[model samples]
Target: MSTPGEKPDTRELVEADVVPRSRWRMQLVWLVPIVALLVGGWLATKAVLERGEKITISFKTGEGLEAGKTKLKFKDVDIGVVEAVTLSTDRKHVVAKAEVVRDVANLLVDNTRFWVVRPRISGGTVSGLGTLLSGSYIDVDVGNAVKPRTDFVGLEVPPVFASDIPGREFTLKSAGLGSLDVGSPVFFRRLQVGQIASYQLDPDGKGVTLKVFVNAPYDRFVKGDTRFWHASGVDMAFDTNGLRVETQSIVSIIIGGVAFESPADSIEQVAAAANAQFELYATRADAMKQHDRIVDKYVVNFIDSVRGLTVGAPVDFRGVVIGEVTQIYTRFDPEHRRFSIPVEIQIYPERFTSRYQTGRAGGRISDDPKGIANYLVENGFRFQLRSGNPLTGQLYLAMDYFPDAPKAKIDWSRSPPELPAVPRTLQSLQDSVTRLLTKLNNIPFEAIGNDARTTLRTTNSMLSKLDADVIPRAHDTLASAQTALDSANSALQPESSLQQTTEETLRELARTSAALRTLADYLSQHPEALVRGKSGGQP
Candidate 1:
């Protein structure tokens, strides 16, 4: 320091004390760098915290999906965005990568549904129209499952009902899936109260099973004895009541639907539980038929033709259906060497008779089917076939009293207990015609014609005799009678005995001659009167 220039000798003498700065303190220039480092670190941490969960959804096709434009929505609210769309390794599906808000991470469960919401029409429903204007989006239906899932298979078709809808699910087993499909309406009293949720063929492939949802208040109407039927198209039926056309609504007719009703007697029954199973009948009449517990089977052998009578033909008692034909077959009798049609019918006694009789002790036709059957059979109760519909030529079996029918007895030992059956009306008419023809055939017409000819010849001979001999004689007698009348006129005198006698004699002779002429004329005209006595009339 002393070796510096003379100017430095003056500056250097003032030896400034260099202070040691604290390690924790920073210089003003270092403050800017430190703040920048802290700011950068905070920004990195915030980026990590806001990031959401990543999910991948697989779809059959990516029709409306976009990498960055499509958004994920639940209940019409945006919850995520699609990041990318790519084909699967197998190229059979379109895989979409998405980032959903962390709040919904737990909701991504196994049953959670994902589908592209686009304008669509299915099962007579128009949906996703709003998505058309807003662009297509990924719709989600959160499931009620606890199992978490990140990978999902998207539905090509959207669900008919959301999981949050207020309803109860039920199952129906049908021999076939008529016109029903997802979104098909279900009606109660012609009011739409539910829809078909889904359907699938049964495991055995013999039938189809449908899952239906009935919303809140209408669900309460389903009872233990509730019946369901196919109410899709116009249900037309022809029975004793004549033509009946039944339908639920125009919407149902178009898309197809189901209808249900609880029997009046089942109103007091408990409501059916969720997922309750029921049998779907083909028609309302079949579904509403009262279930019979007591059935008695009897066979009827008919010698007449059984045309127009089918197995399902109704067995009627006084205009009421009490049974049905179950089987019809030809039976050969070994001893009689003839074929007879045997008809098996199942009768429900409860349809006609009360369990307990009223008014009198023996009025009830119950508790003893065999005895009652025997009693009825002995007292003119008979079965007859009658035309049910003249237009269709359908015949049904009828049971009624026929007091004038010939006596018949039932052989109780016979299997199925044969019930006496009379011929149908047409068959009876045919029998009567055949009997009349047979009687006409037995008449001796040729012999009667010969006898009539013989009688005619005899009468002709008598008339010829009268015309040839008696007529001329009657003319001569009439001439004599005229001469006698002239002579009597000449001999007549007042109170002379000879004159009086001659006048009386002439009067008697004139009467005899007139009688002879009248007899001759009668025999000439009425020739047949000679063979038999004349009737009380002029010839």
Candidate 2:
């Protein structure tokens, strides 16, 4: 404070600088806050940049899916996000671009599945509320180790969560439509245990092939003799009464399923070297094949047999449906040099086999030649044509087996009884009708016309006789009898004096005849009738 000049403060300033002043201050007030802000900003960017393994998923439709907002989740935890959406080359599928966190990469196996988790309410479960928040996404599931960068198939529902069981892949060739599709369920003992992986047709177009995957444990129970059948869609039928059809939930319809039954004695494992081909039979097809055996197939060569045939007509073996007419067709047989009809029939052999097994060793029930001969000797087999539908004029084949009658040998040298060669199915009914018309043309028209004329002439002559001669004669005879009765009644009337006199004379004659017997002895000869006739009876 001594002087305001600089020269005066130099010593004081120097002394103050050398010693310095102990002052209280806030520690890093601005710098601390700035450093905190930098650290927080850096952490936020790191969190946003965190990424996952990328994968591509495909779907049939992308109606509700979104790219940026859609999140890939596993067990309710967000594992990845959809990065982009694009159409496949075929334009039939939606390809979803997804990125999964690196930590989950080891879980991505070949068996991993991706399916859209949409809002679903079924039997008793509801899921997919997150989908409503950010749209649909390709949900992934980690499976066993497999090839890297594998394809992720978008499922319609969660892959049936199951462990790998002992199973085999079989290819089935079928003419009709398959009962299963990709993702269809495979049932064991009526329980859902497996699913169909894929389906396609062979290159030659001969049949369809299906790939099936079965879960373990249950797979051990399936044997080589296991039978599989379609368990989809309700079979529907309608009759004159009302509608008859099966109904099921919408989910079961879209996903075709299968059911299997294992045979009692079948082994657990199938033959490993057996061909990959497996045979599956529909209910109707199985029944049809069973009918093909045992029954004798015959073709009718005459029109009479065909005109009376119809669908559901009895194809009987002794009045039984041993077989049925399945098909009939008319075509020219190039080898035969003539146009002919072919008939196909299906027979059930079980009927005969059952009976054959029940008989003694030497009995007539066996299929052996000797047994057949013995059976024929004991029971005669014959066929008789009978009317099936009287209104439709349809005919059926009936069989008669008579155990009481003696068997007759079939005469192979001579032509058998003529029958029409026609199919018993609906399609062949038309051809049968045509054959009937042709047979009618062979009748003699002139003979029929002459017989009709003769019948008419005889009827007219009889009518004329009854109207003229016979009727008049009966009327005249009745008139004469009436006149005679009237004359007799007139003479007997009491009002006339001659009637009273005749009555009195009849009474006197009765008394005179009683006394005449005694007087006749004295008179010797009393000729009363002769005297009366000569008018001398007055005495």
Candidate 3:
């Protein structure tokens, strides 16, 4: 230090004033920490403000949930991660906690649906199979509602993507639940364009209600008169037309399905509104039966027994079913003084027309029963019970023109027009058989048996008498006659003496006759003398 001070001695002597040169430096050191603190605060604030919103979803199962591993995807684009997996309070479901990026926050809504994506095979569809190897994941479907939401109830099954698709919802009512299931295809003219969304049984247990979805282009096929039928499984039928096997599709055959068709004229009509209620027919035959309309109600009284008749039996015209029996009852007729079975039937005039009476869809027959009855009776129209199923003894009402049958009188003064009936052909045959059986029962079987027994005994006695004496006596008589004939032949031979004597006796008889004739002539001359002994030696 002393050596360096030679130059510094003068410099230090000048600065020896000890001017307290600001013990604090340029203050940049303090500024450094302040800037760092401010920057840290700003970074912290940014982190806090930019954080994504947290969401909770309830799922029936946590099958695909993995803490920090399960990613939520929208259309295969990852948008969130499952942060926590826990059970609901009731333990009926799993609650998955997730953080969704702010970028997609608008997608959350009240109606938004979520489901686990895994390998599935249903209704001829194989979905999410790639997830088998990649592992399962949560799939998110955004809703269109403007209201934002964070809590969600997950779906047990994947929902149809209605946002990207245009379609409609419709309701179907059915009397029975057939092969149709959720995801079962709905067909339009054999083209699959929809599916069954849900089903519910009526509270009364009389029918099943189904909710179905139809895609855009195919939904236009549904109309006011459209017919929906269960096309699932195989349809086998044998009829006058012959055996028929009907199926909508191979998928339908495997998984079950529904099909719909509109009337030809309805093709140009307006499409049914969303959630339009329609009937689901059990079979195509039932759908085509067009049983919706009612035109006439009539009472047909049968003269013969209605043993095989039942409600819902077809009332046919010729071979075509035009109506059905609705009710059967019997009430004593105060005027006619008899209790008769009243078969109440409903007839559809549209059934007789070549095409359905869609123009008359809401129309009904005139209420003038007297006029209608008179017209029908004048036209020789009659109702009769006919055997529909011979093996089952099922009978149905048949309306036909029986020109030669006795005229049927209709009593139109009654509440429901009464239609007189002719005996069924089968009933007539049964009556004939009954009469024959009655006659057979009345036959004198005991008297016939007694007579037959007496005849048999007499015949047996005669046979015994013949065997004991008649045959032997007859044989002896025949032998004696043969012996006498042999003796006569021997006596009358050409060279025998009896033959020569017979010739001489014949000549003597001729001579005696001649002498008797001459004596009779002489006796006639002397009347009294020849009264006795006219011929010689005659007296």
Candidate 4:
């Protein structure tokens, strides 16, 4: 249909179209560099935000940590990832290089704590149970300080969860370290509410010092007079009451625990502040024993034998326990060459203070230290040792009205006022015997023997007369009576009732005489007993 350049053919001819290979190259070619730059810049920005900060952490051992796999967590939330794990150049420790997100990187402060979290059964608690399936992870504890840090040292054992809890801490002094560990549970009425934070030997080496933490609401239960004791493991004991086994829980039986209770007298109490000091008793009994606060101490020097007296013996006031014996020892006086038993007693004056009413124009103690002792002295107060159990020979000190007690005064110069002591009951008996012997030694025995010999002579003379005269007459009468009975018997039949009766009467007479002789012999051997009944020395 196309025509040549002739004018006539112009109407029927058409020129061929000129089309480029592509036109898209022109518009998109410029856009290629711009889009690429924009995309590359976006990727760079993502890398900067997500790439994280690389920091090394020193561990006792690499343990469950791995490169690019172990993740760091805070409060169970993922916060960082481990990039690499390797042993230090010296091989003294393992160092892990971890990448922490920028958001949490500032949390890496001097006070921050980190440790590997794994399946652990500690302090009566089972933790990290999820690690059983998903494997172990690094646990982090953040600090309030925002000062930036990179390098860190990890805790071999995870820090106690109680450290992160909102509560108060206290110090417990114990006789010695028992089954308690760093993470031992602290119990309130056998309920798990806190934990033992740490423990160490006391500086004076007298006991162990323990640091404990109690969680928020439970911490309020800690009053100024709270008492703490080791409630760890199984307490198995056999006493007069029989077998007793106590445990806070099954977990406490295995891993140990600590427990606290309000003081015996907590009528007026206040919440104890953090770092308050308390005594951690060894057992429940000891803890209860500590319920009484020591208010007074006294030393009683007794001249009597302290055989049954021992430490921990009860000290009573009118049969009511007011104190306990703390010590009993004897010291020899070099100058006098005499030994005296010094017994120490701790008195709880609070007992009397609680009994009296306040602000009623009532009796009040004097400022003078010897005021009470002086008043008691006027009231016939004296200390005496009495038998608590005669069978066990256990003796306890008793303080009561002893009006007849020898007048004495307490020596107040000593720390424990020294109240004058009297001899024990048994000692008093021995003293009485010694005094009797001393008086008997002064008697004129020779003159008394002469008088006794004279009396014996007179008694012998009377007996001789009775034997010489009364015996002949009595014998002749008996012969006469026997002759008469024989004559009567001959008159009667051989088996007659009169002959049988005569024989029976003779036998009875013989028995009576024998009994009379035995009685006379007994009287002669125990002349004083006839008047004094019987002596204790007699069988």
User: Each candidate's lDDT (Cα)?
Assistant: 0.88, 0.61, 0.83, 0.82
What TM-score would you give candidate 2 relative to the actual structure?
A: 0.48
Model 4 Cα lDDT, one tens digit per residue, 115-216: 999888766667889998998899988876768789999988877762467998899988888889978988998888888887889788998998898988
Task: Output the lDDT of residue 148, model 1.
Answer: 91
Please name the candidate that would achieve the greatest lDDT relative to the true structure: 1
Tens digit per residue, CA lDDT, model 2, 301-390: 322335544444556765456666665656565796777544444445455545426443433245464345335434555444556555
Where in model 2 is the C-alpha error above 4 Å? 1-51, 58-65, 86-95, 118-134, 142-145, 150-174, 178-303, 307-315, 319-321, 324-326, 330-342, 346-351, 355-380, 384-396, 401-539
Better of 2 and 3 by lDDT: 3
Candidate 3: which stretches are off by over 4 Å?
A: 1-39, 89-92, 202-205, 237-244, 265-268, 301-312, 327-343, 350-367, 378-380, 387-395, 403-408, 411-418, 436-539
- Please, what is the TM-score per model? 0.78, 0.48, 0.70, 0.69
Q: For residues 292-346, could you state the per-residue lDDT of candidate 1 as single tens digits? A: 7767788998998888888878999998899999999999999989999999999
Better of 1 and 4 by TM-score: 1
Clashing pairs in 4: 3-13
Cα distance off (Å), candidate 2, residue 502: 37
- Candidate 3, run of 10 with poorest lDDT: 357-366
Model 3 C-alpha lDDT per residue in residues 173-289, reported as the tens digit of each score: 999878877789999888989998888899999999999999988888788789999998898854323466999989888999999987654544888999999999877876876
Rank the models by TM-score, top first.
Answer: 1, 3, 4, 2
Question: Best candidate per TM-score, number?
Answer: 1
